[model samples]
Target: MKNLVLTFLLTVITVGSVAAQEINWVTLEEALELQKKEPKKIMIDMYTVWCGPCKMLDKNTFQNKEVAAYVNENFYAVKFNAEGNDVVSFQGKEFTNPSYDPAKASRRNSSHQLSRYFQVNAYPTIVYLDENADLIAPIKGYQTPTQIELYLKMFANNDYKTLTTQDAFNEYYLAFKPEFKG
Candidate 1:
């Protein structure tokens, strides 16, 4: 009886720890607040409920232990719904979809002004920003966990300031391998 109880307690503890490893995403405003205190960069997962690939990226790529750990350590991660109703305030401006149609649930609402501000034309766009909330770059499309680790490291290390072109960065990425274990 004692052994059984101890085993159950251990199992519960392990599961709790695993669950806690999941990313704790913040709102864009909250991220900006954090940025004022620290120099950490920001990573925004721009997603919509209807985007199939975005779902897959969340479940497969972002949920990976290594990916989650890296992102948590290096960035103020934000999960922004492209068509969400929330008003996002940035740079002394509020962005919302004033023309959104609630009747057409499947179709996207008028995009948040911030989406247009960042030129996010597609689903599953990953936008990285500097500590000052300036656009670093907007990465379009779904990326595997391994593929994304390169970008995480690049921005985390402030390597973008040195590289002159994407091709140069691509060359460096191809030559590099992640040190973090999944």
Candidate 2:
């Protein structure tokens, strides 16, 4: 009886942990739809299947409990395949991969039109959009949870609006303090 109770408690704990780690990911269209009802910023993880750094971002940063919680609460998170064949509608325009091949589904395929729209030249770019679905910024490369927290808070609090010049951003960076731990 004690062993049974212990197992049940451990199972419950594991389930809760998994739930916290999982981000509520939505498609670009779905995020736009959700925004129309309740306004929130959009965070798109633009990644290609063939990119190793992209996979690491998924396993390390996105899976972190603090990062996932903050993103799920403050933004509509999107996991967009930058090289996939999904058709995305953004700002009243349709975007797709005209050069996507089924044979290279798991390999390096052609860049999606939406990717070009964001000017994302590299893999694992985190694109943030404003509450009105306007472009905020694209943070390139693999970022740890602590590193990403800075931008996440900066945009969530609309700090980017005042940061027009490079000097302002540099000052902001110098004064900023990261709260998320690994």
Candidate 3:
């Protein structure tokens, strides 16, 4: 009976840990739809299956507890496959990867039109959009949770609006401290 109880408790703990690590990633359309009812900034993780750094960002940054909690609470997170065939309609236009091949889905296929629209020329770019679905910034590269925490907080608190010059951004970046452990 004690062994059975121990096993049950371990199972429960494992399930809870898994749930805590999972980020609530929504489709781009779903995020836009939700924005209509309740406004929130949108964060899109543009990645390709073939990119190693992209996978690292998923396993390290997105899975971080503090990053997951903050993003889920303050933004509508969207995971977009840059080379996928999914048709995305945004702002008044339709975007698709017309040349995307299913066989090449696991490899480097054609990029979606939306990626071109956002000018995302690299993998693992984190695109930030304002509450109205307007582009705020496209930060390219693999960022650790500690590295991304600055942008997340800056945008969430409307600090980016006041950063009109490079000097201002440098000042803010230098003065800011990160608290996220993961």
TM-scores of all models? 0.88, 0.92, 0.92
Q: Summarize candidate 2's per-residue lDDT along 39-144 as a digit string, tens digits.
A: 9999999999999999999999999999999999999999999999998888989998999999999998999999989989999999999999999999899999
What's the ranking of the predictions by TM-score, best on top?
3, 2, 1
lDDT (Cα atoms) of all candidates against the true structure: 0.86, 0.94, 0.94
RMSD, candidate 3, Å: 2.1
> By TM-score, is 1 or 2 better?
2
Model 1 bad stretches (over 4 Å): 1-16, 180-182
Q: List the residue pairs that clash in candidate 3.
A: none
Candidate 3 lDDT over residue span 1-182, tens digit each: 99999999999999998777667899999999999999999999999989999999999999999999999999999999998999999998999898889988789899899999998999989999999999999999999999999999999899999999999999999999999997
> In model 2, what lDDT does residue 95 have?
95
Question: Stretches of candidate 2 above 4 Å error?
Answer: 1-10, 13-19
Number of the candidate with higher TM-score, 1 or 3: 3
lDDT of 2: 0.94
